[model samples]
Target: MSSSFEFTSENQDRFSQILSRYPYKRAAMLPTLHLAHQQNGYISPEVEQYVAGLLEVSLVDVREILTFYTLFFQRPMGRHHIRLCKSISCWIRKADRIEEYLVERLGVASGEITKNGNFSWEAVPDCLGACELAPMMQLDKDYHGPLTPDKVDQILEVVSDSDSKV
Candidate 1:
């Protein structure tokens, strides 16, 4: 693993502020990991070492937390990370169709990035806590639900256009 990780000055200050909120440095692990992810887009082995050093915790402790959280990506993600809920609520609502449509439309299998690096998708086993809006998928931080192929196309078009501008 690479050992050249170093948080930026601003992130270091942010880390200090986050650490101050907790009684122990180890308690600040989650937010510290978030800062690292924001900097590097994914938690690599180097990031685990960097975070372990910052929190004065064992690398194993940091790795355990990283592996346990679905939100933390060990590998790089595309501009959009799409998570389709595969829990009971969503499954009964025919979330499978939504997944299939996305796979066909994006030309990538689940948990794979698109050719243009615009999108990555996965079916998550956890409930997204929006059962009322079943068959829901989260694109980045926002939830869209009761999804139809038409809606999926619209969402992809908007995201694609937005990405082009950037």
Candidate 2:
């Protein structure tokens, strides 16, 4: 696997700019946390320590930042995140089968990333907000639903596309 795993030099400049936005460095905590996640795919314990030191905060403070945000991930995750909705409405439409398909195909457990790092799937209950697209999953920032495993497989094609990167 490639070791091209680090925040770019430009991101460092952006971090500096972000930190400058506040009176105290602690005030920049939010964006700094984001920068750390952007650099590493997921927030590791090592990152927690490093950023706490960099920001001169207690590890508890940094841990709080991670726990409070739904977006920041503490565990390792694949390049792409797939969140399947298992709400009452969606489940009635056979969302269970869809989850099984994804799990079997990717060979990964719930709430964990795949071995290839091509995908990480999270099966969550929804108020999916798209009853019209009942059997749905939110892929990254996009919503995909009214699904069959075939369609999900097709989407994986794009995730594995040569041009894609983690």
Over 58-78, each residue of candidate 1 has an lDDT whose tens digit, in order, gives 999998998898899999888
Worst 10 residues of 1 by lDDT: 1-10
The global Cα lDDT (0 to 1) of model 2 is: 0.82
lDDT of 1: 0.91
Winning candidate number (lDDT): 1
TM-score to true structure, per model: 0.93, 0.80
Judging by TM-score against the true structure, name the best candidate: 1
Candidate 2 residue-wise lDDT, 1-166, digit = tens? 2223344789878878997888888888888888888788778878777677767898899988888876788887887888899998889999999999998989987898887787898888756688788899888778887999999988888768744654
Clashing pairs in 2: none
Cα-based lDDT at residue 54, candidate 1: 80
Distance from true position, residue 68, model 2, in Å?
2.2
Candidate 1, residue 119: lDDT: 91
